[model samples]
Target: MSLSPFRSALAASTLLAGFCAAPAFAQHERMSVIANGEKVGFVDVARTGNHVAVQYDVKNNGRGPTMVEAIELGADGLPVSWTLDGKATFGGDVHERFLRTATKAEWSDSMGARTATVRGTGLYIGQAASPWALGLYARALLKAPASTLTALPGGQVHLDKLGPATIGNVSYQAYAISGIDLSPDLILLDDKNALFAVLDTGGAVVREGHDADVPALADLATKLTAKRYAALQKRFAHTVDAPVRIRNVRVFDPVSGKRGEPVSVVFANGRISGIQPLDAVASPSEALIDGQGGTLMAGLHDMHAHISLESAILYIAAGVTEVRDMGNDNAFLPDLMRRIASGEVAGPRIMPDGFLEGRSPYSARLGIVADSEAKALEAVRWYAARGYWQIKIYNSMNPAWVPAIAKEAHALGLTVTGHIPAFTNADAMIGAGYDEVTHINQLMLGWVLDPKEDTRTPLRLTAMKRTATLDLASPRVQATIDRMVAGGIAHDPTAVTLELLMLSRNGVASPSVAEYIDHLPIGLQRRRRQAIAPIASSADAAGYDGAMAKVKQTLKLLHDRGIRLLPGTDDQTGLSVHRELEIYAEAGIPIPDVLRMATLGPEQYMGRDQELGSIARGKIADFILLPGDPTKDLSELHRISMVVKDGTIYFPSEIYPAFGVKPFVAAPKMTLPAPTPKLAGSGPAHDAMDEFVY
Candidate 1:
């Protein structure tokens, strides 16, 4: 469910918001947009007097934004007038404009138009600006008092100097610009304060001819980000060395589909030691957590995810203790997993799935890109040897190579899953030994599309419109269902993702995210309200509405047919996992079953049920404390009070504020053991005292 297309557009809109960085004296400049060490696009800027024009394009994995920006800079180095016209990543039209006059400031974007009286020098951040805008922001902030400025529309921007670094005998000053989103943008500027590069772990937009510096800059970005997360981990992750006792909580047993009577769950050394009676005697040495009659359930699992350092903490905050990474940067994921395991960072338990794609101009740059049959089989072995739970075949994979690849993966005891390759259907892949299909659209497209229709592009998404008129009871649809049922194949619907793509409208919050939208950051709030799919007319909008209805119907049909449903949000945020389960319940699946799919079902699917998934003596200590029972109302998941992953406790109330989210609930009362006092005869009183820290 990565929805890389829409995410790329959002990333381009936000990540490159300040990319316009040419000096007024400069005539022209060019830069390369590098993603995962590969050049994906470029930003070209031409200046004539006070007016500048920017042409920005990024093409990766068959989708990206192409933006044209025109700007008029004021004497203060902020834009007085700016216009952006472009095609968004998923081919949606983008027309954003901002103008500031002597009396007022006005702007219009996907979020609609607004005006405000002129107060001071405010910089307008475009929803679809080029990479040059970041440079524009950096340069202006450098001259402002304390390197801070009032940003237009809302919010403030603050810049911090990150000192200087020398790469290849060239020195550049690095600075982090914050107050824009959940994370800061780390950019390097030349001696003149001109934008040198915008760095991120995923990619970098480097000044032209400085591509060689991308790798180093990206590594630096990762280290800087990791340092911030590490500080948060130290601040939040509470590791009680002694046994922890959570009292007055009812345990939701997935097997029985009901909550037991209030009891005290005790755990130590990252394993549940006992489930005791509520009236059991208390141990003075144990840490006490008062659940206050809340429900204690096994930590939820997001069956589909692409984990990042930021999303890792979000997952914990949302009660997702485990995540199945659908695909990710091969070089980055292993280290991230290691850090999570060693308590160096905060994140969910990651079950890695190796990504395999065929070499092409549109290939995803995350994992292995095989250009031949041998390379494909080699990828299967590479994943097997490295302990990946499965191999995910992507859009560009050759259908002809799947059989051999699946065979190799099966022989190595790894499950086969992924998008239905371009020019092929789900039925063909299932016949070729696919244990599961990645997305619901990937599965349904086989029934609605012709064999020659290519799904390697955004067609896989836009073509879902055809399903609006598709008959569920048709023989063609049944045949695919029959195969899936007979083979016990699973489906990762990522239903929330479809809701985002098909049902989102400009300036209106999508139904799936409406419940929690107001609690998010302004940037994310705006992103969620805008449309990802292009809807030019009422008819087009109706088609998408009907398509979403059909998608739900298809989900109901699949679940009714006894097909395995793996709840996943191909989205990065932990909040989307809650929405994913809600969609399942909304589609008529029982709430208890949806909860099971999110918790125990995934553990069972991955053959780790014996050690994980539910509350029991000797099982791993991974569960969340909620104020209400999710088995009755799935939305209760949003009210998670505390999450314990492998015995380390985290309070959602404490984690949300770091990302600008309003806490859903206050943390439960936690009481640690009293510190021991030193005796008069003890040598060195400080060394003899017991200090308890969270």
Candidate 2:
């Protein structure tokens, strides 16, 4: 231990020589290149009985030299551990992490997750969120998401529906998805190929569809392939270019009144590249409007929408630009969001909320109700861990448990909003720290003003004079408003549903009805119409209608009283969301204000200012162009002829535009001659293409 000077010098000299040689050795690291451009190099831990038979695909991108790396094996020659080797054949690390998945036993048992390695393609397993990936590999492998990526130029990547697979120790089923892109978290791609894109922000994932192609889209993609595709390789690069111009339009500035003058809106590099002076921002890239004046405004936004792929089509067809889904179901929320963002699904931008609800034995679809503060905190943390935008509270939550829930949600940076229990009104909920209240009906159900007004029984409560409609002008209403102001609680007062609830059984008549309903396709119309009947003039129906109307008016009154009203439609589809805007107008709210509700209100509520809401510079390109000015008549909302959700233009009118393929020829009504000689070809398997006669 004492005489070490000479010994230390020799040891240091040996270590220095090793360090210098290490870099040189790493430069020649031996590795094997399997398929898909994956080069794994690693040392052999052990060897098998027979020849080392390794099967893998080779992906040659027509560039880059072939690289060979060590591919570690598991039991039965499966591609288990993989690493990029440096220096020698069985060398040092070269920066590659192949997560080992778990067995299926863990998944089937108590653990909700399991991981297993995929044999053919390592990619299917590597694309999962880390935890899920880890859980999967260490556990079992079931199915892998389909690896095919198809597109209409620039679109989103969805978890293609996949079939099942079996690992050595476990089995699983890979859930499909639409879109996934997250930052700051490892994507866990398990053996089942479940991928969770832990997003850095809450944004809609939208997609276009299998409809006819847009010529302009072709022009754009083909035109900018190089610069744009490079951007594509980067997650947050500026991906789309603004078209030359938008022609022939009416304009509705959310700040402007209805029946306002026409104006042109122009966009460039994802901004109001230009709002042309008063008229249309006409350019050769776009077509001019041929009809008389119509309404033009920013596209509508649905605060809450759910699972239907049809909902996305309905939203686009109806011109709803954005949709904020309130709950998750069917593994649908994430996939739906991704698809929308990817342009794989023709739909609106989606904002998703991990399901939240009162903890109950009856788990209603997405119900996750909680009875304790600790549970609420845990729930918030769990959702935040996933990529949910907000904490959507639900009905039947215990009043006493609200404050604890609110505290936990706020701590985790989630906005809490939903139904308040009957026993506790808006004041109690907000004072307890609720950030927002959804649906206006709940606001008026309180018994504060008329303390002795037989509040318990439904009949008694209905008969009471202190209904929300009455309380709107009372001190109690203002008090609630003051408290909301103090607590900064916003209201997602859905106008259309409330109006429909009021006009519940009016034989479904009204000219404005078509103004809203016309946006929907015939099939959707047929379905909604079916819900209209078996009409009977019963007092119960009358009272329900009255209460509904009162609720609508009550919401309007709240709006009148300076409460920031967010336009929300608990519509499963986008059809009703746009209608809600018009309904808000019918209730005497200004047309400009209606636009603001869909734009500014919810944006403010989510506290996502830098990226969303206004059609301003630097905000994510999410807006619509109208053919007419909606400020004149809310019906003009129907004029959303073009939409740019997430900067990609979705022109509905031209989605299936004629490509000069064929013209319709009306059949002759006269009795046709029977069987014109079975086509003289002697029927030798004639080709359908050969049948054409110009």
Candidate 3:
């Protein structure tokens, strides 16, 4: 999924760290935040006598955090007291405080309060820290023995010195800090160890007057990230040369909603060649995989995803072999797809949806942004020429232009799907030729909101409270459902995203992530336990709860009325897709049907079921090996032992650790064919089989 406007703002906050200094008087510095080549925000820092004060404000696409921070540094250059007060990415109140003493430390933020006894020293990773905090952590780690320090709460922080880099006439040293997040945060420092710039693939926060180098810095960041993932691909991706035989496995047939008898599935050249009886003999030259009586089913599909280098591998690890990229950076996505196709990266097969947003203050910076009706049509043609599967209209789009845009897209044989633009309703979009609606809130908000209430802001989320009291049986609600059914409009509810927003609470894991939150990295674990939607009172909390129930109720209502429901999670982690399936089943859809929606349903919807989706003769081999039948229990989807996509086999256990995730299950035995003997004249046997053993 694309970064929520809120998260985009939050990530922007971490793009720059302050320069370390102990001025006798006072010093000041300023930095600019650039995202996708656009100046979106700024960071200002004032330091006086070991005390630092910062004001960070960012406005990109009309929404960003405006934070004020105060910090007192100890003699060791670590934060002794820090206070942050501001509005979060979605306008949620942010009041975080952290204090460290020689004996102990205490802090309280949105995730609630905690205290830890200090031994010698521990770095407190602030939940809502400003960019300056990065410098604080970096300076402390550089001074520490081995350039490593224990982080409060949990985990450790390690720093590695990357090679030097130069921007313009100035030379700088680069460093990478790991363990604080899934991907290492890369920063540049001058000879004095003063932070100069913080680089990110999406953007960069560079020292003032150096903004011209943002693109170069971002390119460096992307190359660094690509290099890391490339290494991982080399280490984890296993390519099979000979025909592969997966023996002793029962296949779950989504078409019949039943498990077939144990069979030996054979595939060659990335296509399933046969489904033989368990007693069938295998060729000695074939690679043999003992399934150990597991259930093999079609690999799951995440219908809504925004592919990133990190999420790409995570998707494969979670048994998601196919993903429909709802939206993405126009240039970056195709290159990523190319890498995955060339085996330079490990990722799912991508079906990209061209993202089209109207030019507005709140417009998201992805895909194509059009300012006029002519530009909108041009964007449609652009996507058509590029062969986008569909055109996804975003919140800032003009409702008046959707009809023409949709018409143009239809003429070019591209389907239209997306958020209900501000001031417009789902009914209007469907009439305008939207084949599908993107989010549950986008569809339901039209019923609960005034025409003047803009959905381009967080109101699209907080307004869900109004849905708690909405009558599903009312005429207006039924009319929209009827319109959807009549128009064959599909819904990509992304219910898990809404659940994460509305139902989340401080110190409480949202039900959507409760099952596997513990398996996530420490940073993500903390985030999952925090609230995204600001709850002001008991009434507000209850309203959100009731709203979630109504969301499920509305889903069931749509299902009953025969409106096709597409299972999707606007979440990148492949785990959320499984939760999305659970939510669908909980919404009264049958377990078997939910599995179908995740497997064959999306493939059929995308018109690729002929060569993909299920495990059958002549079809591409994209399936997962699991310990239990997902048709009976959707939760079993998480326990994937093996995933085979286009004949490339991946054992989750072998890769999960690379991301700091504990293995869910051990990989079953896979015996490879013996390498061929080389002739005396030949230097050596050079077949791919001689490269490695699985």
Candidate 4:
């Protein structure tokens, strides 16, 4: 149905008449906010006179307190004013506000102020708007062309009506909204165009009276998003019909930890078929490529990534072909894996990690949360049956329960890894059966935190300052490292993850991402430079600097002691991996060793060494072509010219543009070489080259 301006006018007049007079009949809608099948918050909507008002209060899953957002909408349904005021994810402050005027709009948040010219009836979408205002936005977009909208201060939103779904005995039309940076969100409205529910793969805001329908509704939301992204997968993936050949490439040999001499590689059926010297002859039918004598290394692996479609694409564009998804929305992760496997989307091969958190008010809400040891064990078993590579325990988990959970996970053949539970130390976890530890902070916080400090709060991130003063040579610190070395515990320090938390200062660009800052969106570049943990005094700044320095020192110690380190990015996808390796190099690890740790180490840990981790004959064709030798300069890893995953070709230039990222190089176009001239003093050019193949 087209948006009838006259009908909207009539509806506005009717709402004014009814709501202004009776007030109690002010078209109200309310929903219970749910995550992990638990009710943590609620959303209330009310429209009166020529205005619509919505109030949302939800204690998000894990570490997120009760966050509150309020929106006041004008008669045209555009936001007149919006304010998000509360701590949500990771205890980040949620003081965001947007005000729209007749000719302009302005917004202010932790990132600072943004102003944009308003044309016609402009809209304002706050960061907290997803899964809450999606319904309201859907209703407003009925009048928009192509159900498309240009978001305020910049960006765009493309909305799609995904037919109808029934929740709680009521038939409602569902719509999917994309282009929000986060995952696609699903919105539902009743026949009368009344907001019914807003849902995502993890949680939902549904009508208060129909609380039992949230799960099914949440499932519907996941399927709807999957369907949408599957369509995108078809559009983005590129596959070749003929055998492909790449000539003149110096391949990185993970086993040798060095770049080999220039060679030509031929691959088909998603496996490397042969590796010949650069002058090797190629058939006319082969899809030939000139590598320009750059480095071709095994596709990189990120051991500690939180997966998302955008992040997956970004990873591939940066030459990362595989990822170990640390924690995510339970239903969404499996569905995403299916999409990538089926060639419905372009993404890295995912190795799943089951996330288990303890039930506490401050619990981080990404995965399953257990309230008891038995429940935690059950969660572990649940993941084991589904083939999870590891089980990650998080804050809020009872430290006492770690032994039982880890024991069962180990018995079932899953590695146990996680943050040091709140009020617990790494010594206890390592003793209990932790095979790996994630995040450098989670590993070191136990030494710095007061016994009663709750990691479920910001203290986990802020307590690192004490590390600056920590004496690692002391028995107390050395014992922890000793235990890790003795127990063979692997560490994914994610040192780069702490850089922003510790070193980022107000108004200063991140020294870490300075080389590629211009390639990102302005808002992101601004936000990236902002401090995550504010430094209140010079002492605090010094403390943070000391803490960061100490982290590198600890990393060097771990490396020197033969403690395995897995390179992973808990930050942005592709570039963050580069930054992670860069930090690894700064931590005194040689560039070759860092590359080996990033590529071969994780593969060996995952037990895929026989088939992966290098560019060799008969191995999977997953590798990236860089513009320069990464072993000579680790920074060259950031400039991925092309990526080949399962024999599907993707150019960073082509993929970057889709995500608004400026490509670092042009797409590699295949050019059949001219017939080889007679080799000087040689019987045949091909004869000399074939001698090196064996």
Supply every candidate's count of residue pairs whose N, Cα or C atoms clash at under 3 angstroms. Answer: 10, 77, 1, 7
lDDT-best of 2 and 3:
3
Which 10 successive residues of model 2 have the least lDDT summed? 11-20
* Residue 330 lDDT in candidate 4: 82
Clashing pairs in 3: 1-306
lDDT scores in order: 0.84, 0.43, 0.82, 0.73
Candidate 2 or 1, higher lDDT:
1
Best first by lDDT, ranked: 1, 3, 4, 2
Error of 2 at 524 (Å): 4.4
Q: Please provide, for model 2 over 52-150, each residue's C-alpha lDDT reduced to its tens digit, 9 standing for 90 to 100.
A: 222221111111111123343344333344432221111111222333443311111011233443333232222111121222221122233343222
lDDT of 1 at 227: 83
TM-score for each of the candidates: 0.95, 0.54, 0.94, 0.85
Q: In lDDT terms, which candidate is top?
A: 1
Residue-by-residue lDDT tens digits, candidate 1, 1-694: 3644224223533221222344544689898988767889999999887788989898888888888888886665556788889888788899888887766888899988998777545656567777667766777687678988776656667788888877668999988877666666778888877778887777778888989988887787778778889999999988887899999999999887889999999999999999999999976578888889999999998888988887899999999999999888887899999999999999999999999999888888878999999999999999999999999999999999999999999999998999999999999999998999988999989888888887888888898888999999999999999999999999999989989988988899987789988887666777677888888889888888988899888889999999999988888779999999998888898888887888899999999999888999999999999988888888899999999999999999999888768899999988786555468787434423244432
Error of 3 at 310 (Å): 1.5
Candidate 4 colliding pairs: 61-365, 62-363, 62-364, 62-365, 63-362, 63-363, 63-364
RMSD in angstroms between candidate 4 and the native structure over all alpha carbons? 8.1
Candidate 2 has a TM-score of 0.54
